[model samples]
Target: MSLDVVVVGAGAMGAATAWQAAKLGADVTLLDRGQVCGGTSAHGVGLVTRLLWEPPDIGLVAHSLDRFRELDETAGASFDYHDTGSLLIVGPEHEDEVQKVFRTWRAQAIDVRPVSPGDVAEIPGCADLELAKAEHAFFTEADGWCVTMDAVRAMVDEARSHGANVRPNTPVDRVRDGLVRLADGDELEAEAVVVAAGVRSRQLIEDGWRPPIDAFRAQAAVLGHEGNRSGPIVHDTPNRTYWRPEGSGQVMIGDGTDLSSHEPGLEPSVDEAFAHRVAERLRDRWPAADPIHEVRSWADLEAATPDARPLVGRVPDRERVYLCTGGNGFGFMRSPALGEGLAQRIVQKGSPVPLHGCEPSRFEEGYGTGFPMQEGFALD
Candidate 1:
């Protein structure tokens, strides 16, 4: 059967895209090289915060937060959504930066407000944060976290219910124009071919266009606490570490992010020293989580573009080829919005206003060389 859309890479971005496209009545085929949603997002800290600078980024996250809330209520697609909010703790040294971020959020009318050091201690699992020394702190009410793998599975299940053909562990050999050649020699034709395959999306685009995305590694660990009082995500600005309550008696910690080049498909390695460092910080910041040790650690190759934002929508001059990758470290939070917008474009029913700045063709020749890679969660 001819499919209206063939989505490659069934991570959050691709799964969300396929689900929405299929829901909109498009005959969709979602393909993945491995398990759906078991990509970088599965290895993430699952923190969804509203700390953004660009209007497009801020707008998309607002859309995503709304969508996450909407989907949580829908059958077969619950994201295990949490509305625990987020707390940002800035040490005295980085007070300027946090102030700027707070102002940016306020300017956008984001639901954020200042929190005193004492207030930070009140949150569960945050009792012993050297309350007197904390310089700047704020809490964004809308931020939260989720379980990615379960969420993606639920979304794909919903897509299947809508008649989309979902093929897991089906590697796509090649993509061009409107045709996709599978690794096993199967061919599928679709009106639009969307590549949301993380860093690997570069391999598909390199033959026809220069990829502006760079792959780098981000490491994180799960620490087991004594109790189940883990929920809200806390970001410490000076250390660049962020963590939140995970499952019962467990919390997730992330910070060991670097821009150093890392190839995709390679087994990712977590720096042991880095893990210890974050654990030390956790011990100092939140005494309640003290004695919390690393229960597990993981690393994922995160992609970043020159401008620290994802590239979405159709590639200029490349008819039938649309891209949904280049997450720039904000992929999971914005996946639903990206999926919705791209699906609308594929179905030919969108002006795609939010994606105008993220168009793949916006980068001209040699665009990748001059621009330095931006840190994933850096506010500016």
Candidate 2:
């Protein structure tokens, strides 16, 4: 069947886009070089939350959380969607900024409140942390985490149920105009094409057409504890680290540092040094927990934009060619809203969500010279 839309990339963003388009009655085809959700999406730490410093991101993430709830209710299985809440810990230096953000969040009607050291100690697995030394912390009961692959699977299955075609291991060499040329020398024409191929999206477009996206190597590892060590997702600003519960007794930690840009298609490998650093941070933060055992570690390429936001909307000067890349490592958390918004814009020519700041053409104005990788949330 001739597709009304062809979505390149089957990660969380692409899967959600295909599902939204199909639900809106569009004949959608989602393509991926590997199995669905097997890219960076599989390597995500799965920390989903709406506690963002950026005002524009707040709405998108809030909407995404609501969508996650909706999907969980109808998808017949939990995506391990846990509303365990989240904490953003800040030392004395950042206390004022954290307080200001807390006020803003409260004013926005978000369920966020200031927390003191005593309050922090009450949260599970945080009793022995050195957070008491920090000046302040903000806690949001509505913020939480989920299993990325579980959500991806539900999205893909729901998209397929809506009659969307899902093609796995079908790599695309390039996209010209509204046509997708596969690696196998086949071409498929569509009413519209969405490049959601993460870092690889840069390679699919014409030369000299920079998408303002860069890829970075991100590393993370899991640590197993002796007993169940449940707790809110922690974003320790002082250490530039974040950790969240993996299972009943395990926790997953990742480097929140801004890493250098990396080449696309590089084989994912774990860095022992990075893992060791995360382990050190975990030990410092949760001293009460039993000696940690490294269960696993992995590294993958994550995409980022200069503005720390995604490039959504139509590609400049290209008819029916759209882009939904450059997630800045928060792709999974933002995918639901991004996908729905992009689907609406493509199908109805307008979206309910305000996507002006995320337009692809924003880069044409030359926003900044060097990459702004350090601008967004460290754990993104």
Candidate 3:
């Protein structure tokens, strides 16, 4: 039987898209050149939360959290879904702006509140920090992190149970005229195609039809700590750093938005300097904590668009071909909403969530350059 939909790239977005399409009764096939969740998803820190500054992002994350709960409950999956919450730490200089953002978030009905520096130490995992040096912090009760690989595996399993064909180590050379051409010269025709292939999505499309997406290298490191206290995910906006607990006495730290051009599909090398810098930052933030030691470090490529928003609609002038690239480094957190929205656009002719800002046609005129990394996370 002919397939109704063929999804390329079995990362978070593609896997979720395949599952949603198959659940809607479409014959779906999910193809990946490597193992599932073996791309950028594997490198992700798995910080899933709804505490975003932008209205659109807030809506997307809120939707994703709901879907995540439903999937965990009904799909019999364990994503290590935690509601340990998140803290947007800011210094005195950004107090006013953060307060404004906090009010806006509260107006949106998000369970967020502002915590003054005087009381910041009351939060667990934050007691060791130099609270007196900080100005304000926005705390959210519902935001937390999850294990990305576990979520991907669960979704793929559910998709397969729903009759979606999953093929790993199956590379597609290119896509044209509603046909997927394999590297080995085999061709498969489908009623529709969804491109969620991360940075490689550009290569699969015709030259002129490629979106303005580029690959950038990002790095993170895990560290060993002394205490077993699980702390809230903390974003030190002023320092351009973020860290979170990784189990009992372990933690992970990363440079915030340190992006550089990189070749697509190449394994990234860890920067020793960056790893050391992360360790130093941890010490600076919490002087009283046990000395941190680097456990391991990794690097990966994340897709970035001219605008920070993802492209999540039908490709302009491409018949039955859709693009869902440019995750902007938060693909795992936003995958559920993106996948469901894309599927709705294909099968139901409308999305349950608003995708106007993320429409692929936004780049028709010309792609913008230089998106400020700090804007998406409310650092600005």
Candidate 4:
């Protein structure tokens, strides 16, 4: 008997897709190059927020957050979900955009509020911020952060419970529409094949056909701070960085984003310069921040598309193939929702209305010309 769907890449997106697809009664097989949740999904700081508005993904974000909370409440499942909400700080220049976002959230019945920079210190685990030079700030206690790997594992485990076959350490050398060639030279056929292998999805996508996705190196650090690390997640737009409270006395900061394609296998460790620079930046608020107190830091490749939005759904010019990559940096934020939507589409369970601007067919016009990496989370 043939499988209904074969999902490549066992990361969060892949696992979520499998979970939904299998739950809907599709025969599913999810394959991964390494262990489940081992790739880019494992390295994320897992910032969950409705604060991101540029790409206009509020519905998806809301769904993902609900799913995260649901998983946390599940039996034997610990996603380490933290419901501390989130804050977005910007300079005077970005205030207009932030104001629009605030209004939109308010209209949507979100409990967000305009806050002065000094108020940020009041958040339980937040240190005094260097917002003396900042202009606009907003906060909503509805968003939160989570242990991404744990969330991913829970999703995968749920998928397994729903009868999805998961195979780890199984690398696929090639992927064709409705079929995949394993690294061991075996070929498996399915009715639908989804390539969610992060940046590498471009390579496994039917060989010569370029899918308009690129890879870039992003580094993050885990730092030991003096106070409790349970503050609302912060997005410092001016600094192009974001941070969240990480365990008991630690914080995680990210955004050493190298906006260029990272050559595979030439992975570089986090730069000492990045640690030093971010540490000095952190001291403006925390004061005792230091690179020497770094618990762990690492770098990994992140995916991006020309338009910054991800290509989710069936690939253009192909019937049996689909795509779920190139989310810029916000893929993990919407993983659960994305997976559920894609799974429903594949299983023919939802409305036929597409993701609008996010459909994969939009790239069919250019069809492979190299494009610069663009982060999906950006203001107009």
Best by lDDT: 2
Model 2, which residues run further than 4 Å from truth?
A: 1-3, 365-372
All models, RMSD in angstroms: 2.5, 2.3, 2.2, 2.3
Model 1 deviation from the true structure expressed as Cα RMSD, one decimal place: 2.5
Judging by TM-score, tell me the better candidate of 2 and 4. Answer: 2
lDDT of 3 by residue, 1-380 (tens): 43489999999999888888888778999999999988888778888776766778878888888877777776663565777889887888877766776777888898887788777788876887765545667788788877788888778887898899999999999987688999999988888899999989878986446677777777888988766768798887766777788977788777745666666768778876887888878777777656778889998888888667898888877887898778877778889888988888787777777776998888864453344332244355
- In candidate 3, position 245 carries an lDDT of 83
Backbone N/Cα/C clashes per model: 0, 0, 0, 1
Ranking by lDDT: 2, 3, 4, 1
260-361 per-residue lDDT for model 4 (tens digits): 777645665677788766666676545644332678888888877888887888887778898887768888888888888898888874633335576788
The all-Cα superposition gives candidate 3 an RMSD in Å to the true structure of: 2.2
For residues 1-380, what per-residue lDDT tens digits would candidate 2 score against the true structure? 43499999999889889999998889999999999998989888888776777767888888888988888888875465788898888778766666676676777789887778777777665666766554677788888888888998889888999999999999999998889999999999999999999999878986445687777777888888767867789888777777888887898887747467776767756765886777777777677675878888888888888877898889987887889887887778888999999999888778997776899987774343247464356533
Candidate 1 C-alpha lDDT tens digits along 1-380: 43489999988889889998998889999999888786886776766777765667777888888777776777443557888888877767767766776777887789898878768766665666665555777877688888777667777887898999998899988888888888899988888999998888877753557558778888888888665775478887666788888778887888845677776667678776877888887777767666777788888888788877787888766788889988876688888888888888778568453675778877875555334667757643
